[model samples]
Structure formats: structure tokens, C-alpha cells
Target: MAKGQTIKVEIKRQATPDAPSYTEKFEMPYRPGLNITSVLVEIAANPVNTEGKETSAITYDSNCLEEICGSCAMLINGKARMACSALVDRLLDETKSDTITLAPLSKFPVVRDLAVDRSVLFENLKKVQAWVPIDGTYDLGPGPKQAPQIQEERYPLSNCISCTICMEVCPQFNTQTNFVGAATIAQAKLFNMDPSGSVLKEERLRALSGDGGIQECGFAQNCVQACPKQLPLTEAISDMGRDVFIQKVKDFVSR
Candidate 1:
């Protein structure tokens, strides 16, 4: 790679939800320390394809311009990753080619270009009641104290940014199955361990035990590998799976 060398990016573009998808190749002048998001910004500044044809700026979601936002997730070189964290040099080296392929997550419905509707993850999170319940916003001073061990156990699960990369890589998260995926399951575990949050543990467990819940997980563990935050997803899933199973037995006996 030489100074001012161009980076070739092939983007799969969709005009709208009902429109046909097509590929567009863009050549961006290389700059040191360029990330995928920066490349997209450059392309947006100069909306011209490789053929010198004027084109519209690419549409994609981005905020914070950091991995913390979890808004810039897309398929880069066929891998689900955050565009903000994906460096151009590293990607070029990894592919061993001049061209990098960019596309929307296949599991999600594309709104336009690389932007996809990721509301499903929020819906799934809601299903598991992945939050601590509070009666009122009014100063509930000095809440319950938790053991150090409990905090240590639940801390990693709390790092989830809701990027949905776990869902995107999940084998069961598809049109055919209503599988809630690993992120939501991990969130349930995180809250269930909370002192106040544990008040709703049975409710959370019951939610996971229902249709399109924890039982639907195929245990492929693709989610654990793909999560940028390196959340203890498999451990959470495993623990939640056991709890869900035990809950089912308890429910059966009570019946």
C-alpha cells in the first residue's frame, strides 16, 4: 500500500424496503488511520462511483462514531462487525485483497443501503423484561446492596451495547424461528441477578420459557464469538437455559 493509494469498496445498496438491491463500487483515496465509517463519510462527501458517475450519498446509521453507540453495525467482508471499530488497514490485510465488501445484515430488513431495522432486538429485550422494576421515579434512596461476587458475575453481562451482532450471527435468529437470540438472554441473566431486579426473576424466567424464548437457542455460540464487547454470552445463555428448564419443571409440578 502506497501513499494516496485507493481503497476499493463494494457496497450492496437498496433504494428502499420494496426496491431491488444492487452493487456499487467506490474508490476512496487512502488516508492513514482511516476506519470504515470515515471511508463512508468520504464517499458521502464525494458521491461519485468508480466510473466517475455522480451518485447519491450512501445511507447508513452512525452516532458517537465509536463502538459504544452500536449504531454502525453492518456486514464487512461478510462478517458482522461495527463499522466504527473496523480499521481500513486491518480489513485490507485480513481480506488480502484491495476490495472490501459492505452490506446490510442479512437477518435484518434493510431500510436503505446499509441501514437495517434493528428494533427486533429491543422487542426481544422487552419480552424478557430486561430491566429493574421501579415503582416510581421519585428518589428511591440507597437501594439494596449486592455482594461483590454478585457484581463481578453480573458486570460482564451489563457491557452489552445492544448492537445485535449476536443476533445477526445467530443461526436461530431468522424468519423461520422467533428465537430471542443471545443478547436478550444475557440481559435477562444480568437483571435477574440484580438485588431489586431479582424480584421479577420468575417473570423473566417464565418469559424465556415461553415460545421464541431461551428454549429456541440452537447453542451455535456464534453470538459469543461475534460480540465486540466480548460479553459472557454463552455462560449467560447456559445459566438461563438451566433456569428456564427448572422453571418449566416447577410449573409442571404446580399444575
Candidate 2:
């Protein structure tokens, strides 16, 4: 490999949800600090494969190019990661391969190419009621205050970008289990710890106790590892698990 050489990229392409998947190999001039999104942009400009055949532009989701939106997650050389932040130099240095591979995240059904329907994560959040409920839009003055200590503890959990990377990497998050994965569980714990949000605590716990609930998590610790936001996922999962268990016990005794 010489300076200013071209980097070969192999991108998986699919025209539609029902279309069969195909691969399109591209060769773009290598640039220092070039990220995956930039490479795709270059491909879009040329729209030619390594074999010099004309091809359709690659389709992928990207918003907030700074990695906050979490929309650019894809399989980069077999690793599930955000395309925006994955540096090409680092990738080349590590893999020692001039060719880069891009593919859609596999855990979810592809909508087109890199885009997949992630509404399941949102729906799961709804199932857990992952929010602080407020009644009467009329101005409620001076809500309960959270101690700094509590705020400090809850802040890390709030960092979840809803990327679904955690879910994608989790073995429990599959069609058979319908497990909600760590992000949703962390959100459950986030809202449950809020003084105002705790009003519906019992209901949230009950929701988690049902099928596709917290019990589904295998505690593989993959979520904690893959979370880009460095959220305290396992801690939240452990805390929520204990709380859900307690709620179940109380329900059993009262019944």
C-alpha cells in the first residue's frame, strides 16, 4: 500500500425490502481521516463499481453526522458500529486489509439497504411506559426536586442514544424471545428512579414482568460493551431486575 492509493470498499446493496441482496465493490481514492459516510458520498458521486460498471447509489441512513443520532449504525468489516465515527485510518491499520466491507445490521429486517425498521425499540419503550407521566397540561409549578446524588446516578443512563447497537449485539434480542434488550431496560430504570416518574413504578414493573420482559435478558453483558454512549447498562439492568422481582413478589403475596 502506497500513499494516496485507492481504498476498495465492498458495500451490500438491496433495492427494496423484498429485493434480493447484492454486493457492489467500489474503489475510491484514499484520504486521511476519511470516514465511512464520506466514502459512501464518494461512491454516490461516481456510482461505479470496482469493475467499472455503472451502479446505483448506495442507500443508508445518516443524520447528525456526529454520532449522536445513532442512525448510521452498520456492519463495518463484520463489527456493528456507527459509520460516522469509524475512522478509515484506524480500520486499515487494524485489519491490514485495503478493502473495507459495509453491510446492514443483521438483527433487524432491512428496509432497503443500510436502513432497517427500528420501530420495535420504540414500541418496546412504550410497552414499559418509559417516561414520567404528567397530568393536566395546565402549569404544574415547582415539581419535586431530585438530589444531586440521585441526578449524578441517573445521568449516565440518560446517555442512551437509542442506537439499537446494544440490541443488535445482544443474543437475547431475537425473533423467538422478543426480548426488549438493555436500552429499554435501562430506560425503565431511568424513569423508575425519578421521584415524579415513580408514581407509575408499580405499573412499569408489572409490564416488565410479562412476556418479552426483563427476564428475557441473558446477562451476556454485550450491551454494556457495545453502547457508544458508555451507559451504565448492566447496572441499570441489575437494579431493574431486582425491582421487578420485588414487585412480582408483592403482587403474589397480595393476590
Candidate 3:
């Protein structure tokens, strides 16, 4: 991890969603305070491969490069993580290698090079009704008061940036099943905890009770470790799992 050394980078690329995929080699001068995004930006500005041949600019999604938007999520050295937070120096130290590897999430459909379709998460959240219900956009007076303790509990869940690293590392979130993954479940728990949002609690719980539901979770707990936000994902999943079970039992008994 010395300064001004050349860091070799390998990027997985695809011209289009249906196009054949390829890998490109790049060389970036190791610099102080260099992040993965910086490496990508440099390649984008230069668009030259290791062979000194001109190449297309790398395609990827990014916004609020501070890890808030979660758009810079990618497989760094074969691990799901945020590229914006992945510093080249620290990465080299962690891996004991001068070469860095970048690839799109394996489970997702690659839109281009490092970009993938993550709208599935939105659809999952939609199924769980992961938002507070409101009648109109009209001025709704100050809503229900939340205890400091409750607020504290909810804060961590609220920090989830939808990076999908949890899903990427999840075994259940594969082609074999339609498991909604940890982000969706955590959001369901977050909204269900809200005073106003609790109105749809029963519906939300029911949504997760059937196929591709909470029962599908393998409880590997990878979500807890991979989440960039460090969300209480395991706790949320556990609480929601209990609630979903009780909800299903209630539905059965009432029938």
C-alpha cells in the first residue's frame, strides 16, 4: 500500500443487457484517498484498456457518492459492498494484493458493466406496503408522537439505503426461489412499527406469509453483516417473522 504505485484493476463489462459480457483490464496509479468510484471515473475519462487500446466508457449507476444513495453497490473482489466506501489503499491491505476486481452483482440482471436492475426491491417493498399511509397531500397536522426509545429503535432500520448487498450475499435470493430478500422484510418491519403505518400491519404481514414470504428465509444472517447501513436486519427479520406467524394463525382460526 505504497503511494504512486500502479494498481491493476479488472472490470467485468457488457455492452448491453442481452450482449455478450467481457472483461477489461485497467491500470490506475495508486493515490492517497482513492475510492473505487474514483477508479471507475478515471477509466471513464480515459476509456483505455491495459493494452492501450481505446474502450467504451464503463457504465454504472451513482448518486450521492457518499454511500447514501446506495447506487455505487458492486461486487468488489467478489464481495458485495459499496464502491464509494471501498478505498483502494484499505482494499489492498485487506487482500494483500495490488490488483482489484470489480463485477456486477451476480443475482441481478446487468444493465451494463457494473449496473444492474434493482427495481425488484421496489416491487417487493410495494407488495409489503412499505410506506406510511396518508389520505391526501394536504397538510396533515403533526402526526402521532413517537417515544424516544421507539424512535431510537426505528432509526437503524430507517438507515437502510437499499444497497441490496444483503440480497447479493443471500443464498435464498437466487433463481430457485423468489425470496424478497432482507431489504424488503426490514422495510416491512420499519413501516409496521410506525404509528400511522401500522394501519396496514395485518395486510403487510399477510403479504409475507405465503410463497416467497418470510417463511422462505434460510436465516443465514448474511444480511446483517453485509448491509452497508449496518441495519438491524436480523432483528427486523426475527420480529417480523414472529408477527407474520401470529398473523397467519389468526387468519386460519378466524376462517
lDDT values of the candidates?
A: 0.93, 0.90, 0.92
Measured over all alpha carbons after superposition, the RMSD of each candidate to the real structure, in angstroms, is 0.9, 1.3, 0.9
Off by over 4 Å in 1: none
Residue-level lDDT tens digits of model 3 in 38-94:
999999899899999999889888889899998889999999999999998888988
Residue 234 CA displacement from its true place in model 2, Å: 1.0
Cα displacement (angstroms), candidate 2, residue 194, comes to: 1.2
lDDT of 1 by residue, 133-249 (tens): 988899989988999999999999999988999999998999999999999999999999999999999999999988899889888989999999999999999999999999999
Model 2, span 1-255: residue lDDT tens: 566798999888889988999988899888898999998888889999989899888889999999899888999999999999999998998799999999999988899878887889999999989998988888999889999999999999888888899999999998799798899989989999899998889998998999998999899999899888999999999998999999999999999
Cα error of candidate 2 at position 48, Å = 1.0
Q: What is the clash count for each candidate, in the order shown?
A: 0, 0, 0
Kindly report which residue pairs in candidate 3 clash with one another: none
The all-Cα superposition gives candidate 1 an RMSD in Å to the true structure of 0.9
